[model samples]
Target: MSCPICGAEQQTKYRPFCSKRCSDLDLAKWLNGSYAIPAEAAAEEEEWNEADRSSTEPRH
Candidate 1:
């Protein structure tokens, strides 16, 4: 199998990735929201906004 990130041959240690650098790069993508699905993220954001608005309203 080949590395998904760089297309290099897969290494035994990394399994799917060729090296630590590529593995770390993939992780950084996740940590920084590079892998976020747009529809899900938008729904989550809308939920947060609605919650914030409800919290700020004066109580009856």
Candidate 2:
């Protein structure tokens, strides 16, 4: 299999990563919030955006 970080061949120990460096890089990304699961905003936030948008839109 190939490493997700650098696209190199994966090592047995690292499995999906090529080396400790690549594996650590992945972990760092997670720790620093670079890798994240997408989610929708909360109801209140959505409502706020709706009100904001309405105020900015030009009248028909």
Candidate 3:
């Protein structure tokens, strides 16, 4: 198989990526949100916000 990042032949150690550099590059993309799965907007955004606000408010 070829590397997904650089199209080089995949190494045995890195089956999907040819080298550690390519593997780390892919990880960085994920960590930085360069790759994302599509999602529909939540139908209850207001309710969710209210719950979050209530949780953070001081109890008194």
Report, for every candidate in turn, its global Cα lDDT versus the true structure. 0.93, 0.94, 0.92
| lDDT digits (tens) for residues 1-60 of candidate 1 | 999999999999998999999999999999998997656687899999999999999999
Alpha-carbon runs more than 4 Å astray in model 2:
44-60
TM-score, each model? 0.63, 0.67, 0.67
Q: How well is each residue in 1-60 modelled by candidate 3, as lDDT tens digits? A: 899999999999987899999999999999999999976556577779889999999999
Q: How many residue pairs collide in each prediction?
A: 0, 0, 0
lDDT of 1 at 40: 69
Clashing residue pairs for model 2: none
Q: In angstroms, how far off is 11's CA in candidate 2?
A: 0.5
For model 2, residues 1-60, the per-residue Cα lDDT tens digits are: 899999999999998899999999999999999987877667879999999999999998
Candidate number with the higher TM-score (1 or 2): 2
